[model samples]
Target: MPTYRTTAVDAVHNDEELRLNLDLLEGRRERAAIREAKAKLQMTKYYNARVRGVTFSPGDFVYRSNDASHDVAGGKLGPKWEGPYEVTEALGDGAYRLRSMDGTILPRT
Candidate 1:
């Protein structure tokens, strides 16, 4: 008669098998990390290629979005942009200090 053995009983309980399993797990983790990094690099490259770099210099006129402005009204029918605000200063990395046409410097960037 043949005897049936449970997985726990049939499994190799040797140090060599344990070491091999550990090495395999470590290899899988390393490959996964490399794959993740490559995916991130590819995504970054795609994004950079499609993205338009916009930089405002000091004294340039630009319109601001009305969504966060206090004077916005009329719901969806309202004007989507405000200001032909003057760029007072370029704070770098696309940030700027803006001044309204009335010459008031905006408190926030």
Candidate 2:
């Protein structure tokens, strides 16, 4: 009971093609929306953290690292953290000198 020429095409070609395309596009859109939501949620959580990272300047006193594992000259193998060392001068980034216990100051970098 054929009423149209469908010998070389699908019997319901137009309707089926449109439906398949729509289904595929809808799946893509939903995936994109879900990805956006996840990214936003992650960013919000990251921004909400009360991150505390501060630095000090020259002539400030800071607790010297007391790690006993940093000794090339057996420096850290003694105390956990020694001095509330007076940061005599900052050499630029993170290097500093302590006003020595015997008054012989030198940069400890």
Candidate 3:
């Protein structure tokens, strides 16, 4: 039996009616839970799809993307990528802690 009742009439109903009402509430709750689970699963799938598959390992070389403001010096001809920076640490997911080729750790952007 459910601890909560859906209607005031349920309080005055016979045992059978009360049981049926409780069952209905339980079924509704079960369905709601299932719907929530499915929505979460769909969102997870979408997020995982959008996440990059690339992973960086410590000691790997990579390029930093150029900042837009700095591009004025080279104008449209400026190189879009800077550095063959060395990866100092793998920060998980697609993030990395990077160092210059000279061994200087770059500040976080």
Please provide TM-scores, in order, for all candidate models, with all chains considered together.
0.75, 0.38, 0.48
* lDDT of model number 1: 0.85
Ranking by lDDT: 1, 3, 2
TM-score of 2: 0.38
Tens digits of lDDT, candidate 1, 1-109: 5545543453556667888899899889999999999999999999999999889888899999877675678687888989899999998877789999999998873
Q: How large is the C-alpha RMSD of every model relative to the true structure? A: 3.4, 8.8, 8.9
Better of 1 and 2 by TM-score: 1
Which wins on TM-score, candidate 1 or candidate 3? Answer: 1
Per-residue lDDT value at 54 in model 3: 76
For candidate 3, give the lDDT of residue 40.
100
List lDDT for all candidates, in order: 0.85, 0.69, 0.81
Q: In lDDT terms, how accurate is model 2?
A: 0.69
Model 2 stretches astray by more than 4 angstroms: 1-49, 68-78, 107-109
Residue 24 lDDT in candidate 2: 100
Candidate 1 wrongly placed segments (more than 4 Å): 1-19, 73-77
On lDDT, the leading prediction is: 1
| Residue-pair clashes, model 1 | 0
